[model samples]
Target: MGIIKLTNIRVYAYHGCLVEEGKIGSDYRVDVSVTANLQPSATSDHLKDTVDYVLVNQIVKEEMAIRSKLLEQVCKRIIKRIFNEIDIAEEASVEVSKINPPIGGNVEMVTIAMTLHRSDYSDPTQL
Candidate 1:
């Protein structure tokens, strides 16, 4: 019933439909929201009981850095990787945006989002 949000994580990478996009690169702003029971961390004041946001950021960054033509695919990769890799996160939503896309029109960015839940997920460490 509680949450910890990681927001405005800007990643500079090459991911677009155009060939120039993959060659020149662009900016991606991602917002990640993780939901989990934080009662243990709140009560014990221990970092171990909660998710480490730094690790999450690294994961997101790594996923975004991978060159992909579609933001939708990149967003899905982020969601699936978090669900399969991160253990402490019970639920997560990844919102990835393409800044100043080459649409040749008036548009700031295009957003692609995906949400995933690890309710029945197995621990990767154990596997």
Candidate 2:
């Protein structure tokens, strides 16, 4: 098994509970990692045999563009999409960070993370 990671995907999106946050928007950083059997692609030297990083990036960008009230929700959606879309991926995780958030204290960002396995979804059809 091997892991493919897409790190520090920068996006500007409107995702927050505050009314101003929805209107003004904020910068966000997203990271996604997936574990899959890489031996096939490694030996075949073909893109089709491996987890496509391009598709992963596109998923992140598309999901981030949608509005959400919390980072946790964003993380869930990201992980769900990864597992559902990438059939080769056995497991996946996502981290979403809200840069320069509106929280009352000094903080670089507030992040929420979630990990999911293909088996975690009771229904195979859902995966």
Candidate 3:
């Protein structure tokens, strides 16, 4: 198995629980890391061996731009879409973070992350 990561992808969008948060919108950053079996690409030297990060970014941005009440739902939707859309990735680890969220505490950020693997594939972590 091999890994390809897209780090600190920035986006501006409306996502939050508060009326002001959803109404005004804010900056968000996503860190997406995907692991796929690399043997095919390594031997064939073909583009089919890996997921295209560029296309993945567009998918992520489109998902984030849509307003959602909770970050968890947003994260889940992205993961699901990735699994269905990106064929090269066998496993995915997605992190979506909001900067300076509208919270009472003095927190600087809040985020939701999920890891999904194709049910048919072997665990990449064991690789």
Among these predicted structures, which one has the highest lDDT?
A: 2
Which regions of candidate 3 are displaced past 4 Å?
120-127
* Candidate that beats the other on lDDT, 1 or 2, i.e. the better one: 2
Clashes of 2: 0
lDDT per residue (tens digit) for residues 1-127 in model 2: 9999999999999999999999999999999899999999999999999999999999999999999998888887777787777889899989999999999989999988888888777764563
lDDT of each: 0.82, 0.90, 0.82
Candidate 1, residues 40-122, lDDT tens digits: the string is 88998988888778878998899988998888888777767766665667888889998888899988988988786776446
Q: Give one digit per residue, the lDDT tens place, for model 3 in 1-127.
A: 8888899999999987788887789999899888888788889887766677887898899999889988887877777777777777778888999998877788888889988787743543322
- TM-score, candidate number 2: 0.94
Q: By descending lDDT, how would the candidates be arranged?
A: 2, 1, 3
Q: Show where candidate 1 strays beyond 4 Å.
A: 120-127
Error of 1 at 19 (Å): 0.8
RMSD of 3: 4.6
True-structure lDDT of candidate 1: 0.82
